[model samples]
Target: MKKETGLRWLFFFAGLMVLGLGAALTIKGQRFGVGSWDVLHIGLFERLGLSIGLWSIIMGLIVITIASIGLREFPKIGTFINMTFVGIFIDFFNWLISDSNTFSVQLIAFIIGVLLLAMGSGIYISAELGAGPRDSLMLLIVKKTHFSIAAARTIMEVVVAVAGYLLGGPLGIGTIVIAFALGPIIQVTLKYSGKLLEKSVKVESVAHGHG
Candidate 1:
């Protein structure tokens, strides 16, 4: 049991690190636009005196607070962990990479960012610690709309992207592409990652039984 729990923490942190790296890559990759969430981050950064990642943490806290109010319960420790680490990782990676002017390089970076974003989401969420603030809201919206994940995500993305744009965030072609692209990738990774986590747990249980 302790092993299983430890393994979960391992996956959880790995997911967050990958997720943050992906986010940072996207910003440096494309100057034109970013994903819905990044748009919000950039927007907040412009208005406030902070980095994009700091805005991410701030936004996470606000959203989590709202989620707690709606659910009538506090978030799990993993939730807070997710909020803090993902932001830190993003800032670290963002500072690590410089923006590129070449279109091909930009395209490659954006694609990889999207892929890592999905995979990281899958990894963290599979641990079942708790969803991020926006993810929490996504679930709530899904429930309100009769559990239509696709519909709920689309609506939420549109709203967030628009708000970010209004706040002087980057809103461009990449944003449109991200709006259409990320969902299917996240769905696929989430399904497989969950299976992987469960399989690892089963393997651990079997090994423990033998011991």
Candidate 2:
């Protein structure tokens, strides 16, 4: 049991790091475009004079706090970890990886970033630890409104994009891609990863039993 829990924590941390890296890539590829939350992060950073990653942590905590209130449930430890570490990882990676000069390189980075964001989202959430701040709000909407994940995410993206744009964040093709594409990818990743996690758990149980 302890091992299983530890495995989930490992998955959770891995997912947060990947998520931060993906976000960093998209931010560095900002000339090409970025996701809604990233746009807001950039906007906040530009206007408020803090690192983008710091803004990410701040915004995440705010959202998570509100979500917890709305759901009337305390956040899980994993949720807090997701909020904190993802931001740290983002800052660390952003500092480590320099910006892309070429359009082709930027495009490739953006695409890979998007894929990683979606997959990372699934990988962590599937651990049954806790959803990230934004995703927690999304789940709240899902539970209350009976909306599908795609629809809920789309709605949130639109609103967040508008807010970011108003705050002077660049809105471009990348935003469009994220608005439309990310939800489906995340949904698919969740489906597959969930199945995979289940299989792994069962395999672990069997191996331990035999041992």
Candidate 3:
């Protein structure tokens, strides 16, 4: 049991790191516009003179604070770990892949990044540790307004996308694609990843019993 719990934590952190890598890829893809929250981060980076990674961490902290104060929800350790390391990894990846050029390469990077983000989200969520800061806020909104999760998420994304666009963030086809496709992608990813995790746990349990 303890071994399984530790493995889950490892998977959770790995998912977060992959998410950060995906975010960085999307941001540095040059031609591809980023996801909604990333639009906000880019806008803030443009106006505030901080790195996008820094903005992500700051915004994540702000959202977590709101969840605690306004929604009376306490964040899990996984949340804080996600908030901290994701930004750092984003920065690292952006720096590492700073020189990617060409439209085809950029487009490929964007598509892969989006898929990676969905996969990472699914893997982390399956751990049942807790949500990322933005997701936590979305849940709070859903709770308070009695809105469906989809509706609440859409509202938040639209607001942020608009705000970010107004502030001169990149808004392009990729952004629109993400708005429409992300839910379905994450849903499919979670379903499969959940099954995979269940299989792994069962295998581990059987091995432990034999030992």
Q: State every prediction's TM-score relative to the real structure.
A: 0.95, 0.97, 0.92
Let me know the TM-score candidate 3 reaches against the reference structure.
0.92
Per residue, candidate 1 scores C-alpha lDDT tens digits across 89-164 of 9999998888788988887888888788878988898898888887777777776678566567678888999999
Candidate 2's TM-score = 0.97
| Best-fitting candidate, scored by TM-score | 2
1 or 2, greater by TM-score: 2
Model 3 misplacement above 4 A: 146-148
Candidate 3 C-alpha lDDT tens digits along 32-131: 7988888888999898888988888999999999987767868998888888788898889988986577898899889988888777877787777888
- Candidate order by decreasing lDDT: 2, 1, 3
Measured with C-alpha atoms, the lDDT of residue 145 in candidate 1 is 71
Give the poorly placed runs of model 1, Cα more than 4 Å off: none
Model 1 accuracy (lDDT, Cα): 0.85
How many collisions per candidate? 0, 0, 0
Candidates' lDDT values, in order? 0.85, 0.88, 0.82
In candidate 2, the residue pairs with backbone N, CA or C atoms under 3 Å apart (3 or more residues apart, or in different chains) clash, namely: none
Stretch of 10 with least lDDT, candidate 3: 178-187
lDDT of 3: 0.82
Better of 1 and 2 by lDDT: 2
